[model samples]
Target chain A: MSKDSNIQIQINHKPTHLPYSMTLAQWVEHQTLELPVALILNNQFIPKGEWAQHLLTDGDHIDLLSPIQGG
Target chain B: MGPSAPDSWNLYDTPMTSRLWMGSSHFPNWNVFASACELAKPGFITLSLRRQTATGGQSYWKLIRSLDIPILPNTAGCFSAHEAIQLAEISRDTFETDWIKVEVIADEQSLHPEGPELIRACEVLIQKGFKVLPYCSDDLSICKALTDVGCRALMPLGAPIGTGLGLLNPFNLERLRYRFPKIPLILDAGLGKPSQATQVMEMGFDAVLLNTAISQSVNPAEMALAFLEAVSAGHRAFKAVPMPAQPNAQPSTPSMDMPIGDYRVGAELYGN
Candidate 1:
């Protein structure tokens, strides 16, 4: 966990390396996802209010869900 | 005069003018879906959530938003209460609506709702402040359980999902109608034709949720209008209170004042 150390995380089932540790909100803002998306961190829903406080860690599984056709 | 307008009904205390709830799936294209929606004017349209990709669902979401109808998201592929709960939570967050259609499938082939797990999921969702409309079977006991746990509406399937079998058990649906006269009963799934929708509406169902029947039709927009008119006609028929059937035939004309007179006079005249 050094200042310049990169952390690995999985987003939407795809693994990637972040330049440094960032809050969930920072990651979301960085990705510029469409409006009205839901976030699931480690199999649990992380509400928008907590996105700022929840920082990304190595090997974290993040799922971003958006609307689709359904019956 | 033309056909009378359908009376407004309430879903979880929200007054809805349309008795038809359209499912937003399986259309040939978004234009057809939009045309259908424009023609039908459903009170609500259902949608779901999936893992987001780079540009996935953005256009679909935009189109759905443009329609300006309320959304009722579903947990279509969930198998357990936990999965359903998680999905419901995400659905509520994504759609920004408390209304959810809870579906916990017990069998893959049949696509039937798991009664016990459905109830469990509904219970949790209700506790979480969701206006849960559980897609369940035509079982009275299960319906009662869902209502007892504070479900505002019950969506009992006529047959398995997408089968279009059309009310496989009318007896159970009738029983449910009689048993829960106060609750909003939406006939969801397994409807293939507009007449089937009319049949359930005539049977006193509050609404019909349709998807495959309209989406897979040769002309989805026309089919949407057909189902809309069918549902309206059924509602009108139910409200009109049809006359009871009789065991024997009853003459519609004035038999007493007939020029032929009584049977005895007729026999004398004709020399029977």
Candidate 2:
């Protein structure tokens, strides 16, 4: 891995096993990946429609939350 | 027997019951939630926002639309008045509504209201042009402050969070009613049965707001309908005050002198 190589990321503090050397679009399009209820990159709320075009990098903290009962 | 007391309640000046105000928590399943709400027919479903999985579609929002009810956003989780103010803004933006159920929880376990924080939040919310409904303990001071600050209504808690107790502080609520006769007073949270709701309404509460009681009932659809009827009965009774019983020292048996058998007194018939 060179200095410019994509780095690993964590989600909801879970250690991501792999770093996406791919574009954000490519990573989301992977058939095995389930659709996330909500995507957060570095605490940013990303629209689901932008998943394909959004890119992921090393050390990016992506967070997801499930819609549940709250009031 | 005090001349058989007649009904004392006045004909008019009855409290008006609100159509719909719901809490969005505690349903075992989405299907049941949908069915129960449909049967209950609430116009507003209360909710507070937390971060959710952005990967999936907006299922919660979609379901809210499917429920066909207006999203009555809430600041339920916020503890401080400052936090509640911020949450209300975000709720308005996210839900796209200015209606906010202001909840300023001071305790984690019971989730009772911090009256000072509630007033603080209501002050800011009213300034911000939000239709605020502060959920506080059954304290008349808090209710009066909320109304003073221009909150649309005051939603006083019946008991602790999810305790399912009903109108534990009726005395205080009565005082609250006496003070603020104009503002709508809704009993929010901790309602376990329809009778509890009826009692609150009978005491002149404008409405009843609940979630878990109806959602967790053995038959949610039936329970919802029961609440509907109970609320209606309470409101009507408040207006009608059917009659008040007079406790007299003398027995109504007439000293066995005049009327022998107008009605049966007990299992044994008299003069038969």
Candidate 3:
């Protein structure tokens, strides 16, 4: 394992720090996402198939979205 | 009515008896929301997407899916065509349905639909095989353009969103209805009371989408029932074909049955 280093990532536009070189799957586990959700990485969609291997780094704008009530 | 009533209308390819489409937001709690959903018995329910909250889980989504009712996902917060299209695609993936309520609001003050952006987004969505229902203003030309672009249904706001101002321009709504009788016109937003919903349905709108009116009421469940009844009654009135106007008064009685049949007052005095 590599030395733990802080990397900033924006989740739903809220800046947060995670261990550097964290995979998207690890981030999902870190965020405790048990339900179905979609992810956008740097203004682009990151499919679920790629989340397990995709790595996140500093300044990545991530938006975790799920269905909410609306009119 | 068991799903399909005598007046069963079709949206895209689905047949629906109820004309009330409820928005699944703003209820006091989940219990109240469940009760209201049960009472309203809408043909479909609308939902949107947002970032997950700590306390907010996916329970509402599970509950909504469990109801076995049709779902209409919306792009409620999108500001431009790009944002609207992206959210809409994500919604389709999450909801597993192609039905979308395309909303492109340029600002928050009025929450009015950005006509061009909305139309552009709808065009792209329609191309992607989505059943697009665009929430738009009561503009005949814009409505025409939306239909021209092949949206499944057209949802025109009765007034501004959530103000409950009630149909600000019935003239325009009526014109939209008159102009596009074949198009499924679902009156959406700005309806505060059951009567307001009834007015739109009575005006020959195919349906209505209600949110704050029911969810924000003193009793959401009760208000839902009221809206259901009002929508049904209004549809019935429309089907009954109300009477037309008359230019002059007409006697309802038989003219020959009058008591003064032979009584000509001035004729008798001048007979000599």
DockQ score of each predicted structure, in the order shown: 0.66, 0.20, 0.52
Total backbone collisions, model 2? 15
TM-score of chain A of 3: 0.83
Q: List, residue by residue over B63-153, the lDDT tens digit for candidate 1.
A: 9889998988999999999999989887876677898999999999999899999999999999999999999999999999999999979
lDDT of 3 at B109: 92
Q: What TM-score fits each model?
A: 0.92, 0.73, 0.85
Q: Write the per-residue lDDT of candidate 3 for residues A7-48, one digit (tens) a residue.
A: 888887788888656788778878775457777888788777
lDDT digits (tens) for residues B18-114 of candidate 3 = 8898998888997898888888888889988777752255788778877777989899889999999988888877667889999999778999989
Q: Report model 1's TM-score to 2 decimal places.
A: 0.92
The better candidate by TM-score, 2 or 3, is 3
Q: Give the 10-residue window scoring lowest on summed lDDT in candidate 2 chain B.
A: B6-15
Docking class of 3: medium
Q: Which stretches of candidate 1 lie over 4 Å from their true place?
A: A1-5, A19-21, B1-6, B256-272
The TM-score obtained by model 2 is 0.73
How many clashes would you count in candidate 1?
Answer: 0
Q: Once model 3 is optimally superposed onto the true structure by TM-score, how far is the C-alpha of residue B257 displaced, in angstroms?
A: 5.2
Question: iRMS of each prediction in angstroms?
Answer: 1.5, 5.3, 2.4
Better of 2 and 3 by DockQ: 3
- Candidate 2, chain A: TM-score against the reference: 0.65
- Scanning candidate 1 chain A in windows of ten residues, the lowest lDDT window is A1-10
Q: Residue B251 lDDT in model 2?
A: 73
